[model samples]
Target: MKWEKLGLVCTADRFGVDVPTRVMVPTPVFVNEDTIRVFVTVCDKDNIGRPYYVDVDARDPRKVLRLSERPVMDVGTAPSFDEHGVVVAQVLKTRDGKLQMYYSGFERFRDVRYKIFTGLATSSNNGESFQRVKTTPILGGSDYESTFRCAPFVIEFEDRFSMWYVAGSSWETIRGKQVPRYSLKYLESPDGIEWPVEGRSCMELQHDEHGFGRPWIEIDEHGTYHLYYSIRVCSLAAYRLGYATSEDGLNWVRKDAEMGLEPTPGSFDSNGLSYSAIIEAHGSTYCFYNGNDFGREGFAVSKLIK
Candidate 1:
C-alpha cells in the first residue's frame, strides 16, 4: 500500500552508446536469486527505440551489475510493422524453458502521429539474444482497435494466455498536438502466439484521462487481481499512476486514491510517472517505473512497505 523510493538505478550512459539519449521502460525479471535483469529501451537521437537490458543486484537494485552490449534484436526493415522501433514490455519464461518477450512496436505515419502494435520475440539461450517470431505484429491493428494495440502484459496459464493491453481507434488533439486515446482491453489466446482480432473491453478512459499505459497485474495468494497502470492526463500533459482491483480480470473497480505512489517534487519523476512493472524477489516486493518525459532520467525502483 506504500513504498520506499530507491531513486535512479541505471541510465543510457551505462550502455556506452553515443546514439542513445534516454532509457525508457524498466521491465524487471529475476535471472537468479541474486540478479534482477531490468529489460529497457534506449532511444536514439531521432527518438527511435531499441530494447536493451541492465542487470542489477537483487538485494540492492541501485547497484548495477551489467549492461547489455547490443540490442536484444534490431528494428525491422522498411515497410514492416516494427520498421521504426520497439519497446520491451514484459518477458516471461515458457513452459518449455524458453523466454517469450512481448514488446510494443512503433511505426510512424503521415496521417497520425504514429501507430503502435504488439510484437513477440523468443530467446532460446537465456535472455542474451532473440529472434522475431515474425515480421508482422502478433497483435496488430483491427477494425475496432484501428490505431493502437500495444503495451501488453500477459499471464500464461496451463490452458490459455490472458492479456491486458492498451487499445483504441481514435486520436485527439490536445494542447495543439495530436495524441492517441486508448484504454485497457483483455484477450484470451489458446497459445501465446495467436490472438483474436479484437479484445474485450475492460477499463475505459474517464475524466481527463486520454490513455492508459502498460497494465501490470499482480495476483495475490487468494487469486485477487491487482492491476497497476499509468493514466495519461490530457489536461496536465503528463502521466499519473492508477490502481484497480478485479475478481475475474474482466471487470475492475477503480481505486486511484489508494495507489499511494506519487511524484517526487524536484526529482527525476517530479513531472510524470509511467510504465510501471512489479516483481517479487527475496521476500521483497519491488516496483520498477519510469520518470519524466518517458524516462529521460532512466528507471528507478520502489520497495513496497505495506
Candidate 2:
C-alpha cells in the first residue's frame, strides 16, 4: 500500500491561534462513526503543558477543531503521583464501560533535577473528564537510573493492556556533561495501572549512525502490526521515521522502509517528520505526524489497496 499526502490538517498559525512555542504532538482516535477526537499537548514558552481535546466532524472539509471548554486532565497535587506536569495522553475505551488514558508526567521539582515517570487516569464518561487512579507510576525509573520516562502508547490485546514508552538518562549532566542515549521499552498491565516487568529494554539504540526512539503501533485490518518510530543520529532536526512489523506484540522484525516518511520538495514538511500517531478508520489508514523540525502537525492518508 502506498501513502499520499492529505495536506495540513492542523497548523500552529491556523484559526487565529498563536504559533505553539515548544512542540505540538497529537493523538488522533476515532471516537465514533462520524467524529474523530484529537488530544493535543500545547506547550507554551513557560514550559507548562496543558491537554486540549478537539472534536471534528469526519465529513467536513472546512471543519473547525472545537476545543473542550475545560481540560480533560492537568497537573495537580494528588498526594500520590503526578504533581509536576502531565502531557501526551493516549485514550482508549476499555471493556467495562470506562475510558483509560495512559499518560506521561514529570515532577516539576524533580524535573528540575531531571526525573520523570508515567501515570494513568480513567473517565467513566467518554473523555468529558478524568480521575487519577489510586495506583501511580505504573512504570518508574529503571536500574540504570534513567532520568526521564515519557511518551506512552497503549493498546488492548487479548483482554490485556500493552504499553510502549520512552525511557532515557538525563540529557543534562551533574557538573557539565551531556548524555545522548534514548530508548523505547514495553510493559504490560491487566488493569492499566500496575505494570510488573523486569529490567528488559524491549528496543534499544544500536551503536550505529542512526538512533531510534518515539515508537507508535497500529494493528492493520488483516491483524498485522506496524510500528513507526523516530531515527535520529545527531540533532533532532536530522530525524526521520522508521518502520517495523510484528505478528505477536513481543517479537518484531525491521522492515525495508528505513526513511518511513520524509519531506516533499516544496512543502512545509520539507524539513522532516517524526512523532507519528496512526489510526485506521472506515477502511482507510491515516498517519498523523509532526513536521518541519516539530514546527507543526500534519497528516497523510493511504488506502490499504493491496
The model with the greatest TM-score is 1
lDDT of 2 by residue, 197-284 (tens): 4334766665442345457787878888788877664543355667888887566776636534667867766777666776666656
Note the Cα lDDT for every prediction shown: 0.90, 0.63
Model 1, backbone clash pairs (residues 3+ apart or across chains), number: 1
lDDT of 2 at 162: 81
Give the distance in Å from residue 261's predicted Cα in candidate 1 to where it truly belongs: 1.3
Model 1 lDDT per residue over 143-222, tens place: 88988999999998989999999999998988998889998999999998999999999998999989998989999999
Per-prediction TM-score to the true structure, in the order listed: 0.98, 0.81
> Candidate 2, which ten residues in sequence have the lowest lDDT sum?
297-306
Regions more than 4 Å wrong, model 1: none
